[model samples]
Target: VAEWYALVAAPGAMEAREPLRDLRGALRAMLARVRGGRRDRVGLGRAEPTLRWLRSLSAFTEGEPGEGREPFELPRFWDALDQTFKVTSQEATKLSLAFSRPPLTSAEDCRKLSEDVQNAILAVATVYYWLPKGQGTTLRKMVRDATTEVVKGMIQLTETILSAPLESLSQEQLISTGGVWEACEQVSNLPRDNQAAVASALAACLGVVKDALEEMEHALVEGQDPYSDIVEDEELGFRGNRDTYWSEADRKLLSSCMGLMKASKACLKKVLAVVKAYGKADSPEQIAQLDDLADIANEISPSVDELALSMYPPMNQLAVRLNAAKLASVLKKVLEITKTSHVCPPSEEGWVQFLTGAVDHNMNKIKNFTQGQL
Candidate 1:
């Protein structure tokens, strides 16, 4: 307010003051709501549009400024940006935490927070005016990334609330609350905005796949369970022996399992490379596709972990087969998504096909081993 008033004498500076003032008012309103918010209810339909819009804005930020650029500069914008972000973060924390107690956060309180969110959106959009003409893409991306997290966090919290029965708190609700906070906490750390963050995240997924692969390799090469070292000796008598060594059955099933895991790791590696290097986040649909790829890749690691954990002595072949099938299913979903997303364009399609073949072959081998066809 002081900054704007100070510049009031300057020509054309008057126009920026009202939105800036409105932003201040919105934050204050949100602050009050956080201090004593009520319970709430909302649908999923309201949330998806924000996600889609942010993705579109993300692409808009990436483009050449062209003729859409506007004027009216603001000084010390980072200080203001940080302040609004802090308030918005607090609001998200309060709303998400509210969901933890009896009675969900109220629709009205959400609307209050949303006012702040919108103002915060306006606050960051000021980056266009903050930077001299040709605001570096970095700041613009920061705007989009920060806004995306805030929007997505709120939507996630709302979705969690909507799905949970009002009669009682559910595990999904608790888990999603933590997720919302974790995401909100990452706002300051979105290095180069959503693109870079997605790349870094996909890289993390790749690392997890590698870890799972190495774990299986140890199980294969050492002929021992990789997750534990304490060896349980085989019972010699009629009590159904608990063998310390891999049964001929174990080795065959594990060998095929390892093959499938290797294929999984390779598929992830190839997909990560494609997304990091060439995935187009240039449109809402494109960005949503990238998100789907990330989501499906994330799903792969947990399945691999489950399969690896089940590979120990007294191994349940059914469990192993089930896990492998789940992984293959997720892999297939990745292919389904890649058919349209930039992650597997025509040029990259061949490797996906090869990986698909590997997954299927290894999968069949495991089925054969599990079925006593070995």
Candidate 2:
């Protein structure tokens, strides 16, 4: 297509329009033939077999015990799998992007990339057979499901290159290629077991709380908005000649809120440590309890964010008071749930009590700040 357009646009091409038309038709037909040509030596276009073979391997080893190879530890195995997926996904994207840019990748080079892509995904599938059979059915199933997503994405991306145009990367090709990276990303979040799931949920919550804490900290401590360094929250709607400002009263209120945010952060961090040390999911009831615990912990970050944001310029004392009440309730509830949950044992009860007392103290301090006391 590119060659035909170049030839037609050349000067005096109108004098040779018939030959130009012929060239265009021939080029179009040639493109079709090339697209429909015999499958490459590596089975690039005829990829159903490769995908089916990988899926069958997953099914075959779904129940089989590991015997031939020294099985990798689940965490190590998972991490290795993630790295492989990322590298393979990057390679596949690189090929597509190379063709999209100038000096397009050659057919031979594309074949080589496709072969590498296929081999990488095959390696991922084959590892399951070598995985330890002692893995719990749930964890195993989760692993296989995530693995299947990656394999499915890999096959889709590889197959897309077969029909890709030589001129530029098409939208369909971009989506197909992106599917692999998206699936690879999910692998990072894949939990090893239910215990890890609970911890992940809390860890994610802690991450959000930390972000809010940092943004407020940056604004208060460094006097710079982390998100928009030059723009003040007060000037968001109406720009002004006045410089960005945060009054001392607002600072003190934000400071007190930060105190509560810090308390929430510490409480979650300590609870997460306990969860890692004592959390159990051996039984059905225990598993359900952990899930409930995770859900409760997930509530802290958003409340922390809401209360913290209310402390921005022209601070709404009413909104601050309301959000503070909500955060205090959430923290107390999380602490209460952690106290009776499987993650919290009788031995850790004293530690939890101390943690609860710390939360109460911070909550009271914030309460006083919002109420205009020292």
Candidate 3:
């Protein structure tokens, strides 16, 4: 019960290295108290099995260390386990005395009581000793059997928590920084104060949208196919008309933008992972490969941004509907580093088609929202 409470109330504490020290302290105290007792207090019959168990535990604990083992040395760990074995045996004696054999009891009852007491003592001894031995084979099986019912009780509670919806998040809280706010201000024509307030709110919403999309993407990558609330949110927003003069072209730009963005993040993840595995490549070819990848990611960024602009050139009498400049600059720097010199500028046809589709989607959503406001 104490172990269970420790697990429940302070699960994080289990991760720290000091618990073994506490166990050692408890064992030492138990040993001091037990030694003060009369020599014959624990009979030979009781003492023999207890001593054998302690020896087994000590042998296992003092064995040669394995690679990447925990910091606690084998000797110290063995001493601690040996002490705990003594403590558990002492407790078992008290229990045995309290439930002493009845003189006239049936032979079966006496046998069963003895077996129960022995099993209890063994179980406690096994756990105390096995922990330092790195997932003991026999002990794990015993613990699994003992904790099965307790674990079952926790299942429903765990399920409820796991199934719960993500907590509500404001737009400002979702984004990493105020970059989205600046973009919103550039695009929206609201009065200064209104734009400031609305952009702050919208930036937060955009941040949340980005986070939700990332979660979905990650889940998809992991083969989890998480059910998402983003689709519902998207449907509730204004739908744009795709037939506008530049919609087709503008959408192509957005596609390029997305590709460059994804590639940048992907390349970086790969580079970091490679560095971790191989540890600073010394060869020129290896260094070149890493450098080339980085440059390619950078170059792609600008090309996509340019595509976005060409597709959505400012219309006469109409303010620009998008801001693609900042994104373009990021891409230019990437291209310079990759220095692949072979650039895949956004294809005109592809840009036109992409812009057409995006404009249609955005216009329909926007029209729907405007009508509702009326």
Candidate 4:
């Protein structure tokens, strides 16, 4: 009867509480039958005590292995051989302490019982440490839990860009794909006087893409077990119904962050093409147009910041977040490279070097961001 209860209490042991409760009742009846001479009828000692011993052993083994292993007991016949084959370093000391008194044989059982008690105590402590720090802080706890999902999104986006083909993309396909290119063109085509409108539309698109990327990356980064922090709030602890709601909340947050990243990447690529084209111009009016490209680059700064903010746990360092700002600075440098070429160095080779550094520095930044380091 106790062995049956042991099986039921094991992690993920019974499919439902109803099964466990039913099993418990059945076990109690079996114990009553054993005490009522049913086992003697079968010519074996009453099974109640033996069953209880096995159950005690089962409880002693939980979480100690740190890996998957079934809960079971060895026959007492093998106990001596098992002890001889592998006496642990502490076994002698443990045995000596157990045999220190008249009831010394009970020492081993007492040690196992002590271990079982310690395991149970530690389990509760682990859960308490993960829980919200204060009373009525359920919302804050939820947000902290949700942040893991957000970081997963950013990690996914980084992988996507890392694996992106370096080969040049088709201009026609880029524009028609309704991704970053299309969004960029839309921003560019707006009336010159409506700079605010252009910024708004670009910003909105960037926002969606950046958010989506963050969520997608976060999903790929993996998460700690949600039940790890679960503690018994007495009757309030069994809120299993909240699982779906919490999962849905995670999905929404991840989706929003990924979308924002996607849009930002697209718009930035389009703005880069425009900058490259404008950089080749010789007239003062054309050179002044570079300022507009710089303005667009500045607008994308928030999305970069968002991406960095979402990469956590792995890339919690400020240097990692600063890479995005460095990329933006590099883009600005590209513009300045074009602007100052005729004035300072007075040589085309010097300008070429500046352009080379712009590309090389930004590429390094991308590499660091993708690797979740700085």
lDDT of 3: 0.34
Per-residue accuracy of model 4 over 1-374 as CA lDDT, tens digit each:
85675564433322222222222232332333322324233322334543453344334334432124342222321232223212221232332233233322333464353343223222322222222222112222222232222222222222222232222233432322223222222322322221222233445545554565565476545543355356646877653444322243334333333333443465454444334332333343443344344444554555455554554323333443354445445445544544453322333344445544554554454444345442
Model 1 agreement with the true structure over 205-311: per-residue lDDT tens digits: 77998987887677667665442444544564323344554666688888888887787788777777887788764555666676667667778888888888888
The TM-score of predicted model 2 comes to 0.54
Model 2, span 20-138: residue lDDT tens: 22222322222222223222233223345444534544443544545445644666777677777777678767756755654545545554655565556556655544554344443
- Colliding residue pairs in candidate 2: none
Error of 4 at 214 (Å): 7.7
Per-candidate RMSD vs. true structure? 14.6, 12.1, 23.8, 30.0
Residue 351 lDDT, candidate 3, scale 0-100: 32
State TM-scores per candidate. 0.51, 0.54, 0.19, 0.23
Go through the candidates in order and give each one's C-alpha lDDT. Answer: 0.59, 0.64, 0.34, 0.36
Tell me how far the alpha carbon of residue 72 in candidate 1 is from the true structure, in angstroms, after superposition.
Answer: 16
* Candidate 4: regions farther than 4 A off: 1-220, 228-247, 277-279, 307-374
**How do all the candidates rank in terms of TM-score, highest first?**
2, 1, 4, 3
Candidate 3 segments exceeding 4 Å error:
1-240, 243-246, 279-374
